[model samples]
Target chain A: DQQVKQNSPSLSVQEGRISILNCDYTNSMFDYFLWYKKYPAEGPTFLISISSIKDKNEDGRFTVFLNKSAKHLSLHIVPSQPGDSAVYFCAASPSTLYNTDKLIFGTGTRLQVFP
Target chain B: DVKVTQSSRYLVKRTGEKVFLECVQDMDHENMFWYRQDPGLGLRLIYFSYDVKMKEKGDIPEGYSVSREKKERFSLILESASTNQTSMYLCASVRPDATGNYGYTFGSGTRLTVV
Candidate 1:
């Protein structure tokens, strides 16, 4: 079963515009959500994260909003630059167990920011 | 800065061959994970180790085994390779936060082809 899902396989946005990537999760037990950006042939780098306790978290140009009732979350990048073009993955973890740090990840959304 | 390193960037092996993928983390993280990423499938966890000599099977652990003899190294072993195992394999390590939230530091990834 896919607990986390990224419905859109690809997204395109013009530079200087806003780019929004969405993610949905079927597991309510997940309390922490993170977004990672990956470039071709490189490892995924951490972008931003939000805890379930908070509805939103902002980190400079990136903002993540979580709606627990809807089991959905979104990452928004303002003034999207060409450098922002990459595959973005949404991952979640349930903090119920102290020793468990496994993350469930979405299929990923390929974002293309054009000039 | 945390660095996770994978031994190989690419490898080609024949079916039924035993393959070993090595991962090492500079940070003394207690949590280490192995995942396989494929088209439209995202990243599926193969195994994880929380501490030295301790391990747990993740979502897709079949046909794969892992060893964490030392806290800084985690290795994934394919008992017998298959064509279906051809994909990008990722290694990650996490240092847990006070709230049990983890931000993963990932390796560049190893692309394995089973011929």
Candidate 2:
């Protein structure tokens, strides 16, 4: 069974608009969540992350919100730019002490920021 | 900065051929991982090594094997290549943290096509 899920396969947004990508996970044991952005022919690069102890985390134009009660999380990119167009993947993992930092990832959502 | 290097950017192999994908890291991290990214399936782990001569299976281990004879290198071996095994292979090195700062640096994936 898939522990993490991204229901949306693709999303298109005009430049400078707010782009929100959502993810859901089934395992309540997951305490750490991460977002990674991947371009074609390249490996993924870390974007942002949130811990279960907090409901939200932000970095400049990117913010991640976690709803622990709903087993859901969302990544919001404010003023999304063309350069932000890529496949975004949400990943979840339990404490490293338990799983040795093995990350379980969602299928991924392709975000397209067009002018 | 830590960097992970994949030996090949692309490879095409015929069915029933033995394949090897190499990964090397330029950091001191002792943990290395191999993952395959497929369309609509995100990234799935195949194998991981915590230290030299120590390895662990990940979510998908069938038809794939790994070797970690040195600290800076990890090798993924396909005993006999199959078309089903064709996918973009990525290698990563992990840095564990307690406060949700788990850093995973990935290489520029190698795309393998088996006919």
Candidate 3:
């Protein structure tokens, strides 16, 4: 069973515009969500994260919004740059005893920012 | 800065061969993880270790084993390699009991191909 899902396989945005990536989770136990950015031949790097207690968290150009009722979360990047083009993965952890902060990741969405 | 290093960036093996993927983290984090990433499937956890000599099986632990001989090193073992095992393998580390996320740091990944 896939606890987390990223429905969109790819996304494209123009430079200086906004890019939004979406994620959903079927597991209600999950309370922490994170987004990671990956470039070719490199491991994923942390971008931003949000706790379930808060509806939104912002970090400079990146922001994450969570909707617990809908089991949905999104990462928004404003003023997108060409360097931001890469695969973005959304991951979640339940923080429960059994889960132990183990991350369940989505399939990832490839973002292409056009210059 | 945390550095997670994988033994090999690429490896090729024949079917029925034994293979080992090694990972080391400099941060002395308590938790270490192994994952396989494939197209359309995202990242799937293979194994994780919470402490020295302690290990846990993850969602896709079948046909695999792990070793945590020391605090800084974790190894993934494939007793009998198969073509299906061809995929990109990643190792990550985090603090086991920390709530604020000592944040997961991932290795550059090892691409394995079994003929």
Candidate 4:
């Protein structure tokens, strides 16, 4: 069973515009969500995250919004740049502060920022 | 900065050959994970260990085994290679107690091909 799902396999947005990537999860036990950006042939890098208790978390140009009632989350990147073209993965964990750090990742969404 | 290193960046093996993929973490993390990435399947966990010699199977564990003799290193063993197993393998590590401050760090990944 796929607990986490990224419905869109790819997304395209113009540079300097807002890019929104969506993810949904089926597991209610998951309370912590994270976003990772990965370039070709490189390891994934952490971008931003939001806890279930909070509706949104922002870090510089990246923002993550969580809706517990919908079991969905979205990552919003403002002023998207060409450098943002990469595969973005959404991961969820049951609990992070108490040692349960096993992440369940989504299928990933390939974002292409056009000039 | 935390660093996770994989033994090989690429490997090719025959159908029946045995294969081993090694991973080492430099941050003294207590949690390590092995995952396989395919074209559309995303990242599927094979195994994870929270402590030395203690392992738990993830979503997909068939044809694979793991050994964690030391806290810093984890190895994934393929009992018998198969063409179906050809994919990109990723190793990740994180502190078990890590929360918002610490997230999982992944290696560059190893692309394995079975002929």
Candidate 5:
């Protein structure tokens, strides 16, 4: 079974609009959430992250919102540009003394920004 | 900037042959990981190491083995290549953190094709 899930396979948004990508997790112990952006043939690059203590974290045009109660998280990209088109992956990790520090990743959502 | 480098961008190997994929990180991080990416399945961890000569199995470690004799180098070995093993392999490195909120730096990835 998948511990982390990205329900949307693809998303499209107009340039200069807002793009929202959603993710969910079944593991309640996951306390740290992260988003990574990937291009074709390239490895994933870390974008942003949020801890369970905070409900939201923002960096420039990218914002990540975490809802621990719902086991859901969303990434919001404002003023979406064509350069932002890529696959977005959501990952989570548990915080514990014995934790291995391995991250569980979602299936990923492909976002396309149209001009 | 942190940099993780994979030895090969693409590799084609015959079935039943022994294959090796090498990765190196310049950041000197304590944690290194090997993962495979497949369509629909996303990224699945094969193995990871937190210290030299210490390794732990990840979610998918059936046909793969790893070596971390040194801090900066990690190697993934396939005892016998199989067609099903064809996928994009990624390497990542990160610093150990108790909060579990640290982001990982990933290499460009290696595309392996077993025929």
Candidate 6:
């Protein structure tokens, strides 16, 4: 079963506009969430993260919002730039007894920012 | 900065052949992971190692195995190559933190093809 799901396969937005990508999860054991941005032929880099304790976390132009009750989270980029176009993946880590800290990932959403 | 390096950017192997994908992390992080990325399947964990000489199967470890003889290196091995196994393989390393991010420090990825 897919514990994490990104319903939108892709998103297109104009430069200098807000781009929002949504993700949902079916596992309640997940306590932490993260977003990663990946470009073609490149590894994914960490964008931002939110703990279950907080509803939101912001890092400059990138912000992540979490809603624990709904098992949903979103990444918002303000004034999206052409350079920001890439595949965005949302991952969740659940607290486990083995301390593995394994992450469950979503299918991903490709964000295209046009100038 | 942590550097996770995959030995090959791309590889092609014949069916019934054995394949190995290597991943090395410079930071000596205890946690290492192997994930396969598909068009609509996102990233699925194949295996992960928490320390030297230790490994565990993840969600999709059916046709794959892994090795972690050293803390800095983790390798994914395909016992028998099949067309179904052709996909992008990614390796990641993570330093355990209180914030819980298992998706940190990923390598560029290895695109493997089986014919």
On lDDT, the leading prediction is 5
User: Clashing residue pairs, candidate 1?
Assistant: none
How accurate locally, in lDDT, is each candidate?
0.93, 0.92, 0.92, 0.92, 0.93, 0.91
Each candidate structure's count of clashing pairs: 0, 0, 0, 0, 0, 0
Model 6 stretches astray by more than 4 angstroms: A96-99, B99-102
The lDDT of model 6 is 0.91
- TM-scores, all candidates, are 0.96, 0.96, 0.96, 0.97, 0.96, 0.95
Q: Per-residue lDDT tens digits of candidate 4, residues B8-104?
A: 9989999999999999999998889999988667889999999999999999999999999999999999999999999999999988664353468
Model 3: how far is B70 from its true place, Å? 0.8
Chain B TM for prediction 1: 0.96
Clashes of 3: 0
True contacts kept of 1: 0.53
Model 2 TM-score on a 0 to 1 scale = 0.96
Error of 2 at A68 (Å): 0.2
Taking every candidate in turn, the Cα RMSD to the unseen true structure, in Å, is 1.5, 1.4, 1.8, 1.2, 1.6, 1.8
Q: List the residue pairs that clash in candidate 5.
A: none
Report how far residue A86 has shifted in candidate 3, in Å: 0.7
Consecutive 10-residue window with the lowest summed lDDT within model 1 chain B? B94-103
- lDDT value, residue A59 of candidate 5: 98
DockQ of all candidate complexes: 0.58, 0.57, 0.53, 0.63, 0.54, 0.53
Question: What is the C-alpha lDDT profile of model 1 across B23-108, one tens digit per residue?
Answer: 99998989999999997999899999888999999999999999999999999999999999999999999876675554788999
Candidate 5: segments with Cα more than 4 A from true spot: A96-100, B98-100
Model 5 C-alpha lDDT per residue in residues B5-113, reported as the tens digit of each score = 9999999999999999999999879899999999888899999999899999999999999999999999999999999999999999988756555578999999999
Off by over 4 Å in 4: B98-101
Q: Candidate 1: where are CA atoms >4 Å away?
A: A96-99, B99-102
